[model samples]
Target chain A: MTRLLLPQIGVEPPERCDAARNRRLLLDAAALLVSERGVDAVTMDAVACKAGVGKGTVFRRFGSRSGLMLALLDHSERELQQAFMFGPPPLGPGADPVERLIAYGRARIATVEVEGEVRRAAENSPGTRFSAPARAVSVTHVVSLLREAGVEGDHELLACSLLAPLEATLVLHEIRDLGMSTERLEAAWEDLVRRVTRA
Target chain B: MTRLLLPQIGVEPPERCDAARNRRLLLDAAALLVSERGVDAVTMDAVACKAGVGKGTVFRRFGSRSGLMLALLDHSERELQQAFMFGPPPLGPGADPVERLIAYGRARIATVEVEGEVRRAAENSPGTRFSAPARAVSVTHVVSLLREAGVEGDHELLACSLLAPLEATLVLHEIRDLGMSTERLEAAWEDLVRRVTRA
Candidate 1:
């Protein structure tokens, strides 16, 4: 069977093993560059050199710098998505809607706290903050949960409201400017999710 | 009593009646231009033409286009702040935390829904979005309400989470792209507030 290519939307899976290996190398290099230098300083050439690959290969894999950032974000977000989608009971499928929403928030907080840098890098990209596929998926997940929780009226909008708390900029502002603790954030989130989900 | 100008932060309130009237005229003209041609298109000269005032008068009232937009946003935001702080009950002072939160959300939603274009214009300005006195006041108001509701743990962060849902961009996205009804938005907000404020 012939495989199809959708370069613009980036929907195609890995084409070859070497390409996959190179992609992994690029991501690892990109992460290191991001740690060493900020998002602005991490160039495709630097990533290519760090990964011991041609700059052309890097471009082929990621298309552009924004594409690379999105790819990195997608990788981490996919792990998070998997954790909430199918990995365990409370966050996944076994628990009730209220419990699941709570679990989802906790998981999200943990994810943001851990992957703060990556999340910030992705957001720093201009004009693409709300267009990430992972963001859409997360919103859809929350909306579905709100529906399951019996909250009537615009479940999607309500889901957007739920996701509001997890905004990367707001989260950063809270921890950095407001001196908020993870425990405090988690507790407030618990309250918020409970109230939003209650009958 | 002596009036001292606070450098880089506060300005002295102007005293000339005609200046104030012309400023109002300029602001009204700017608002109409914003409603018609958007904030970006409303030039000082255009404002003067629309307000039936001279271009120099427009310049005198507002130093630049940025100044004009700031003045317009400041005027509208002040009214909103006044309404929430001292206008009536529920949204003001007489109601419980839960009711107040609901009222506040609904009011904010309505405001954003109505004045979205102006709000978006104000927010798009560089270096002004976060520092605007109105934004700061709104944050303080929400924080106070969260504390009043006995929302424990990082009340500031909790307030931010609550405020995040009312973001102009998110509200526009929900209503425009998501095709949500205002009624449904209000209902979802009510549900969210009830869930968030339960003891």
Candidate 2:
């Protein structure tokens, strides 16, 4: 529960349970709406109606449509980050660097494949998603794996480079505009991971 | 000798020799001005004066500053493409697939390092540069190497994935905003290429 930061001000936490429930409902409704009609059609009133919450609740939960989109993106990214960091053997702690790297990339590809539209909407919005904590988490995870693999290079740059292939814009471009298949994308990731983790 | 396309129009043949020479002069002057005072400070009349060409010649050669900037980007990308395609081994056609892939990444990093400002300007411009012949050429080269390496993935997607690391915006962000060293970038590229082309 990170406090929402505002210019020259910070909000206190200990949010009411009801208010938190309403927020969750609003986000769920918004995600449903986006899946049904894309980001453009997911209005505040519509979300409120879908969630059985008041319009004010929707607005309070996320100040605007862009804010709502950001919240959803943050939520999705956080869950994915947690899974990669602590959940399983291959993607988390116990696996070898090569296997973990492959697991990580495949996991990322699956995340993007599931949340691709929301991710694209967030990216097309003005700011902040790329610099978010989730992105930092992913970079740190990749760098750690690179070190474990004995990659004798700038691990930080290598991490960024590894993540570059997963950029929303490029992924969307490949899937939507270029008629590329997700199977192909997955295979490419496997190839990339193999090449990168080779001794 | 590729035809340059005007906005909303089909491509046209190369401009006459004299026009090309004048365009070159204007571009050189504009580059100098931009280096000294940034892209915003360079002007048509200033470029004309610096190049010892008439203002009308500058206008005729480049239509406007935006057009001139695009021409310069196209020019640089073309030269780099030519060098990699025909000039020498490693970066050129004479090297093995794995070596060529490494060279391509290194060459692209060097290109972004040298003409970085120009690449950034092009990146910030509206519309995608995917359709550019330079991009097409690079894609073709990468696809050829992927084939040569017997990589079992969609050649198009894999080539793009490999190229994702070399994107101008990402590269510039890493170097300029993150205070990353060029050595770090080159090393990362080497690591990436080795990973991408490994058997």
- TM-score of chain A considered alone, across all candidate predictions: 0.78, 0.85
DockQ of each: 0.49, 0.49
TM-score on B-chain, cand. 2:
0.84
Collision pairs in model 1: A195-B195
Best by TM-score: 1
lDDT of 2 by residue, A61-110 (tens): 78988788778887777666666656686876778887888888777677
What C-alpha lDDT does candidate 2 achieve relative to the native structure? 0.72
For each of the candidates, what fraction of the native contacts does it recover? Answer: 0.61, 0.66
Quote the positional error of residue B129 for candidate 1 in Å: 4.6
Docking class of 1: acceptable
lDDT per residue for candidate 1 within B1-199, as digits (tens), equals 0011111122457669976777777787887887677656789889999988789988877898878877777777766666666668787667776787788878877866446767765544434445566666777777777777787656666677778888776776677776887778888888766667666
* Local accuracy of candidate 2 as per-residue lDDT tens digits, B1-199: 1112112122358878987677677777887776677666668888888888788888877798878877777777766776766669787776777787888787777767556667766644324545555666777778877787787666887788778778777787787778887777887777677766666
Candidate 2, residue B40: lDDT: 68
Minimal lDDT window, size 10, model 1 chain A:
A1-10
TM-score against native, each model: 0.83, 0.83
TM-score of chain B of each: 0.82, 0.84
